[model samples]
Target: MARGLVGFREQAENQAKFFVSRGIPIYASVLTTALEMIAAGEGHVPSVLEEAWKDREFSSPYERALLLCASMRFEALRDSSHPLAEKIGDDADGQGRVTREELDRAIDFGRTLDSLVRRFVQTNEVSRSITWQLAATCFEGDGPIVVIDLGTSAGATLVGDRIAQNWQAADGSPIVLGEEKRARKRYGLDRRPVDLADSDQEGWLRACIWPGQRDRVLRFRRAVEEVKKAKAAGELVVSKMGAEDMVAFVRQIANENPGARILVAETAFIDYLPPDIRAPFEKDLGDFISAHPGRAVWSGLEDALAPVTEGGGKRFPAEIRLRRASRMHVVARCEWHPSVVAIDHAELAKARTPH
Candidate 1:
């Protein structure tokens, strides 16, 4: 997987070039960190890289690997002969190191790209939806409510939502809540085990923040911190299962919770499944929601715009047509069943606007 070193570096340099091009004033320390992470095979690279750079004062190769690896699938970097191709092993002395070959092997740009894109879409939805939903409705009742998040990535989206609903602070700033209400239940389901180990993933998350949007970053960071605390306290739970399994789990949760309202958010996740897989998944999901009857919001690349037509006669709507150049679109759907509930279409429209 090590073939793309030159190209990866080119992209990195391109990124660096972009910063230079726009005069963004990236810290040199950060640049060095980015380089090392990109070059090194293994070590406490990701975590150390993250901890050392928390001040936003440094970025490293490690950080770059985290960012670029999580988001891009550039084929040139997919050589498996590199040092990073396999998990690095330790010597008798307990020191960790990886050869350049390993680094070369470990780089798979496409998977990383998918991960990064998924992350971006989900976080954008949370930033836009969670705070308002919590303030307006989620916490309105007296008793606690259960939350089941399908296709949860690292459970970050669910955790972020709970924090927003339960925490005293407003969406951005850390405003303390006088009320003591808290969500009673939380569950997350996904096919792949979310990478709790990747601090650079967290850091890449940090990088996405607009300078003026400090509060949004803080909100997410705080939510993540809570999950860490819960895990430390032995209260965190996440189910390693895919869409089908998750739907089943939700059914059980619904039966157990009994009238407990549900919050289901699949941020940019459902589109990955082909129609055949998606049909059963969607049907199961629709059934579960219909049975439980609560509020849910789904945001992703929409087939509405690019409908897969039969007979090969048509394409998606004019607006939904995939951008020939970027090939990315964001769409979200929010529903509240059982007679009536509120949906802010305008807010969804604003959130779905392409980044």
Candidate 2:
């Protein structure tokens, strides 16, 4: 909860544990380790994390750490060099400890991180589009579809079905795939739209990812090229829009193509919304579907939205809900980079989620 909600000190500790639990490289733990060191109030490490801990300008403490690390990483590259050129090409594991130089650089960089955190810290976890594929399974229309990703970054996941995916269970058994292949029109709505063609902006997105996951990094790069190809084809476009306008956007599209089905989705989007605004935003799509039936469905993939047990691990389900049908079902619980999955086809077929 600290990851989504708040608790600066506890958020730091839990986020560190989360990275370790996710099998993220040991190098990523530097965020927590430095905070612990800074608690001493004096030394080579500057005590700057304290100021941002309780601040309410941004989302969670975990995001604060991401912003801090990303800002610092880029700040180190002011000398006209790729920040991750070596890390991307190298296959070596990050050693199990944070270095003194890392601490020194982080300290120097921390002073400038607050402004960036407030302005430019958002994740475009394109891999989370597995949920979009699952959600697409909800509407059975074959007359093409509309997919609007609210947390769109470079709109990578907008081309999900086009991307090769391997879905499996904990024991590595293949799961039955859904019919979420291809979309007629895909529009990504985001407050800050990223242009993958821009190296500097793209580098910042790369920096947000935790270190030492070479496979994830490679997959993202490939996805970037795919998105570029998609842009050329004009099948996908990311609009500079906010989630607040999602209802109106869908309505506008529906007016354009009354026969086409629409799926409004959010992957880890609610975590960044202010507390007062979360409730209205959470149910806006659902309410929209209720008011105007059959054309639109809501799909939400967030950590705290729905939790279920699968593959002997705590997992968050990519849930699909249809108001008119009074049915809802979870397609799967997608883990990191989500080349793997755990889905119950029987449950999905039965629409186990009660309306």
Candidate 3:
């Protein structure tokens, strides 16, 4: 419990700091107060989080707690007339502190504590730019590209590959991919996939967005809309399955499409797996890639601290890796949400060594 509380505090404070730096003062204030309340064991917050604190299901207690807070705020903001909707704003004086009564009200607003725990972070669009970059570098093959998205909540990331998006590199150059190189085939797997066409699911996706990031909210909504349109036209498919199952399915697809280049991508999903499962998953991935030498690539944009025995013990805030034909490359070390990316050419040159 003590470790959980300490971890939760650190995560919350980090989230608060990020929001503050991003100009969302309202979120920063709410998260800061939430952290304080959790530390003091005040209000119903501690009781609400008690089970999660004890459970080892969460890889990051901070993320679990912070997402709960965001969920509450999302629920509160859904009703335009809600007190919090008017209080949270970009204006300096408009960022009001979250009151105990308001917190209680949010708790009573229908979503159970356990339900919030089960909710996955669906911010896959954040990694779209980086995924494109990886595809360009790792998948320099002739055949059509097939992207299999693991832990694909709402399938926004899968859909993102099909649509046109503007992204800037670290040096502010525009990043682009030709239509031919884009994933002609897209498949997504999730324990529970959110249907973008459903109003309730759409609302939940909206709720998942941070309170004040209008650009992100808009971007997410647009992605959802595009996916819905694509699905209706019979251009995409997202299946309900776990990560391990998704890998098996990818192998089957590879068998069917002999020469098609496969790119298995996961962003922010691998961190949720337990240590026991995570290691096996990586091994399974390596074995699968080894089975089909030059036809496949496994790309990941995950926490830099993920336990990798190789790579010389250097730590980064976040790391992007592309593995193809027994060779692994540490492509970039970037911000958690890599809206801007810095490519390490020197590291890229050295990454060709067999892992």
Candidate 4:
């Protein structure tokens, strides 16, 4: 349902605050002003922005707003001549606050990029590969594993073992966990799979990230190289399947390999799910977990699902966890992406306890 002008402003503000907290002030300034202009009757705001709020496919006005924000970044990145490019440059000014004129330019730029907002936010965050790998280390000795990813996007995460995890402690020292290669087979499902080989598809993922964050872009690039290796290995083919179908496919895999452990994972993918679909998928997957008991594990590297406090009594914005049925053990707290994770030895030790 579309939030009217009033409701749109509120949600946009909330999302803007989140952007600021996440250290993307350029986005924070642009998006808040863009939606504010739409809410009030100022400037020639794009009608498609309003249309998306009404469209059921887009669950939130905040999401649509960011899509528009990212589209501007994409446009700028593609063509330096674009009006929005000046604000999204890789220099210090790009990371700073947006001026009123710059914000206006972004609103004007929205008309050209309005249609892009309808597309889902398909980040397929690359650093989350490390998070999944960290969680898998907990059960490394259990048995051979068949890794399945729901909403796998480009299937970059299926190659977690291939990702270089330069892990860090809360005190900022390196903590090596050695190499991992336990997964015998890996599979992934995405509603619309992105072919990393395709430049256009790859460009979109690059644009989804805030410009000037070179570390994140570098991590994504590295992961893309790893995903190529996985693709060459097998049908780590990111099948075009919805969440429910992905669940069913996972079950089929589980039945086929009774001897192997089922490691089902979601990497920042839960927030993409609308409430109605997420509910049913949870019920179906929960049923699978309940039936399998010790055999099946559902791990999630999610911001919304992270515990409030980790093993060390420190709080984090996001966490990696291992879940079986209703029980959960948070394996680590991520201070930042692509690197800097605080593995909680206390909770990791608890993973050994039988449920």
Candidate 5:
């Protein structure tokens, strides 16, 4: 848990072993347990946890993180001395139970974990293979593009990808991807407004850094500045809306902008939807494609794992999925072409800045 949540640490190996004993996938044991420790420490239990820990079922790392995240909301409410009052407090307005401040912090932590963990996993050849497989499915095209990011927290990945991407041009010529000259139009959407008010975001971002990786922090900071400049100039726009609203908005945008290529990347989203809710969520994706036809793209990680399992290997379903869904793809690529965009050093350098 500590290793997964906190990044490379001495005890990660032991903790990972502990997780293996429980039949919880090592990835999950580290992440979910770490999240639980953090969430419970902050004073809450997620509504989905009990379900998450249920008997044998596939559980995704992101779902575990989300469950931990959603539960963090109850900390203030659960802190009350009286049970009834606490229950009442739990029922208190969302403001009292989960403040915007807390949510922002939690989400930031979750995203940091997402980024760091991905980096950690990528070090392994197998993980790299998996990433290539997924990426191949995403970056397929001869494309000079306009990028649209969904669930783009603080526009980190979108800007980072743009800054870091190394891909071929539509003419099949190798383009370094970020010359900082391409007039790439970028947009982002999410249900909650991200309060990236400098200091807070930077603090949260810095906390996620691994010791020798301070260099990455510097790069992340530069990328963040680029994004900030873009937003300030109105070249980038991030909207507050739920998944459904986002789909509708994107549909409209895609329809109106035929010549502009769209790329939708949902970093650590898509596992929050309950199993029952996945149909509609997927339907929304399909609908967006049907509406925009070949012009739009959508990418995300889907947690195929069940949330919990009993003591011996009996897996059971939870109210939500736990997988980390972080991928990018174009609608047209799904049908005719599929490829992965390699991250160039320049883009990675720019992306390593402090949030």
Candidate 6:
């Protein structure tokens, strides 16, 4: 467990630097301080780090633990009596420096390791840009479009198409998305789907947001409200299913609506899949596309452009691929959250190569 925590600490430091580069200094500070506490292995660090080590298959233990700590800080920022509340308030600019004493006090006041263990980080920002791009790409298709979201916790991304959001290109040109509401059906598949109406679930969702990111927090709140409205109207359907089941469901939907374009979308998913599962999952998707040509598309915003093999390796230039009939085209290489997108029209125009 200590060894694992060491690995997690290293990953956390990298994540802290990454967030700092992305202008989320609050997250960087939180994660950096969290790393210090974990390295010390004292004062709530053991309890918090212990919870993170439970799942050996967990993809981002450092990130999960950091978010848990940030959630505690967020709660502290909300309360007046908390010792670190004022010091660690929700001011992104104010996250200049966090002392060890403040971190210890905050953790002691907000010790909920069990809740942290049960929760998963499922941010909806990645879906914002993805939905817009999908709308632009498939809005002109023959029939109504069907969207299937894998790892769709709380069904947030499933309803992304209906939400009103704006995005700009790297060149500062406003990227216009298709306004047509052609998404006839939306399905969310998760092994354990979160109930948006449940207060505990809602709290966990809010806790997943990074500390001091007011815009992201506000966007998430709005997304929750939108999801609630959709659920009340019976427009969003969530199933107790995994990625394999989701693929089968997509096939079923395609068969039922032959003319409809079936789009399988996943954001920050796929990386968690074990190598064994990931390989077969890709094969299954490829077979499905081969069996039904020009009828289905897979759009994914994952940590990597391609799935990681048994021997792990790092690749550069993050890209979004639109796969159709077993052919993939690199549409754009986007930032981590895809807020800034650089379209690769030349690469997209090239013949569909093996993905």
Which model scores highest in lDDT?
A: 4
Candidate 1 lDDT score at position 43: 41
Model 2 worst lDDT run, 10 consecutive residues = 80-89
N/CA/C clash count, model 1: 39
In model 2, how large is the Cα lDDT of residue 194?
Answer: 91
Off by over 4 Å in 1: 1-140, 161-182, 195-220, 232-236, 294-355
- Residues forming the 10-long window of minimal summed lDDT in candidate 1: 332-341
Give the top-scoring candidate (TM-score).
Answer: 4
lDDT of 3 by residue, 197-227 (tens): 8876777677666666565666687787777
Expressed as tens digits, the lDDT of each residue in 174-243 for candidate 4 is 8665445678677878888889988778877877877667766766787788777777877366778988
Candidate 5 — number of clashing residue pairs?
A: 34
In model 5, what lDDT does residue 235 have? 75
lDDT of 2 by residue, 183-279 (tens): 7778888878998888877766766665666655666777788788878888788889876776678778868877777777777676667766677
Per-model TM-score versus the true fold: 0.46, 0.79, 0.78, 0.82, 0.45, 0.81
Candidate 4 residue pairs in clash (backbone atoms < 3 Å): none
In model 4, the runs with Cα more than 4 Å from the true position are: 3-6, 35-43, 46-57, 89-94, 99-111, 140-143, 177-179, 271-276, 303-314, 325-327, 335-340, 353-355
RMSD of each: 14.6, 4.7, 5.2, 3.7, 15.5, 5.2
Q: Give lDDT tens digits, candidate 1, residues 282-344.
A: 777766544432233222323344333323332222111111111222322211100011223
Local lDDT at 204 for model 2:
69
lDDT of 5 by residue, 1-355 (tens): 2222333222334444543443434223334445444456543323223323343232334333433322332232234432222212233321113233343344333333333222211100011111112222233355544555556656655455434433332234553333322326677776654435565444344333222232344555666676677788887787777776676676677677776655555544555556665577677776665454344445443332433333344332211111112222221111001122222334323222211
lDDT of 6 by residue, 1-355 (tens): 3333546666777877876765657567767887777767757755655654566345554655555555565466557677656544555343566676766666656544544555556555624446334523643445677777777877876665555545555665755655335666677888878887887676666656655666666666677887788777776688888766667787887888877766677766677787877888888887876776555667766564453222122222456766667576667655455555655656555423332
lDDT of 5 at 97: 30
C-alpha lDDT of residue 167 in model 1:
24
Report RMSD for candidate 1. Answer: 14.6
Best first by lDDT, ranked: 4, 3, 6, 2, 1, 5
